[model samples]
Target: MAGRQRWMTVVCVVGVGMLTTAGCDGTAEPAAAPTSAATRSVTPPVPRDLFSPRPEVVRTPQEACGGTPFRAGAVRAYTPDGPRYDGPGPHPVKLLRMESDLLGMGPELPYQWTGPRPAQLVVCEYEDETFDSRQVGTCEYLGGTVLGATARVQSARFVYRVFEARTGTLVRQFTLRGNTTPEETCPETTYAKTALYDQQVESKDLVAKIRPLVERDR
Candidate 1:
């Protein structure tokens, strides 16, 4: 009987130990994993000159004259290296209107100007092309190379003007002209030539001449 009682005590102690271990295990909580730094979102840095008051000029589709007008916006100015930011208002002078009346026969070109209240600049293009051809061979040589073959003459013109928006006083004017004799087989269209003339030549000349006049007015 004592041996059976000791065996029962030993079994009870083992059972209690197992139950205590299970209870402790059930009460314990699991630890959470920490978040990783790599998963966080980050924004890219913007260019400093993006908002530096320099206008953006983009070459647009060609128009009737086969000359594409460069669309200018975002900021305002002539060029990054050519002119300083003229500011956002009451430009040295406002552009009222420009009339090319090209060769004294073409229609007056479109033009405009303004300041903080209204921002406007009109640049127009005029182009004309002529084709001349002649035949100099007999029926035997029909379709053969002609005497004159083909001759094409293309002329492009641009006029820019600025005037005081309020008083209609002319501030500056520029006349730019260029000619191209494309191959005889080439079509009657060119791309972005007018934009180049205005942006590269006319605008540069205008700024150089008018900058001094503008200072005097101030």
Candidate 2:
């Protein structure tokens, strides 16, 4: 009888030990992993100047020749180190707009390219391109190529150059001087905001008016 009682105690002790072990195991919790350093470090985007790969010019080459009227000046041809003037110069075409009718272009703004991408594909492409700052900023020091324009006293500068990405041929261009600076840097923004009512429209207006002076026999 004592032997049987001792066996029962041994069994109960074993069961109690097992139950205690299981309860301890159930109460234990797992530890979490550590987070990365980036979770603590964050930064913001600020505007600054940088080099651009586009061609720039101060004067148009096909200027109002009573010549090509658009005057793809040294800047247009993509070589000029300085501006172009009318009269006997290396580039014959001079004077972008000679008519007195286009002085008020800032009223009706003409749509132009901006940069950095804002909302969707098309609208985001032209976010920062407007040059309303009236300050001189650009990729002026890049060594690839350069174009510039000059008048009797004043010369113009374009911060961005528009070229056929497919063929590399020069197309349209925008300046960082006026209120028409380019916004985003994406190449796909070429088709967005096809036109605006500012100086761009004024330039086109002058071109349309002088079409007869330079539009050749083609």
Which digits, one per residue and each the tens of the lDDT, describe model 2 over residues 45-135? Answer: 5434333445543223222111222323422232233322222212112232322123322212122211221101010011123334232
TM-score, per-candidate, Cα-based: 0.24, 0.15
**Alpha-carbon local distance difference test for all models:** 0.32, 0.26
Sequence-dependent TM-score of model 1: 0.24
Q: Would you give me the overall lDDT of model 2?
A: 0.26
lDDT of 1 by residue, 137-200 (tens): 1112123354222323334454544433222233455565432223321333333222111111
| Number of the top-ranking candidate, with TM-score as the measure | 1
Instruction: Give the count of colliding residue pairs in each prediction.
Output: 2, 42
How many clashes show up in model 1? Answer: 2
Highest-scoring model, lDDT: 1
Q: When superposed on Cα atoms, how far off is each prediction in RMSD?
A: 20.6, 24.7
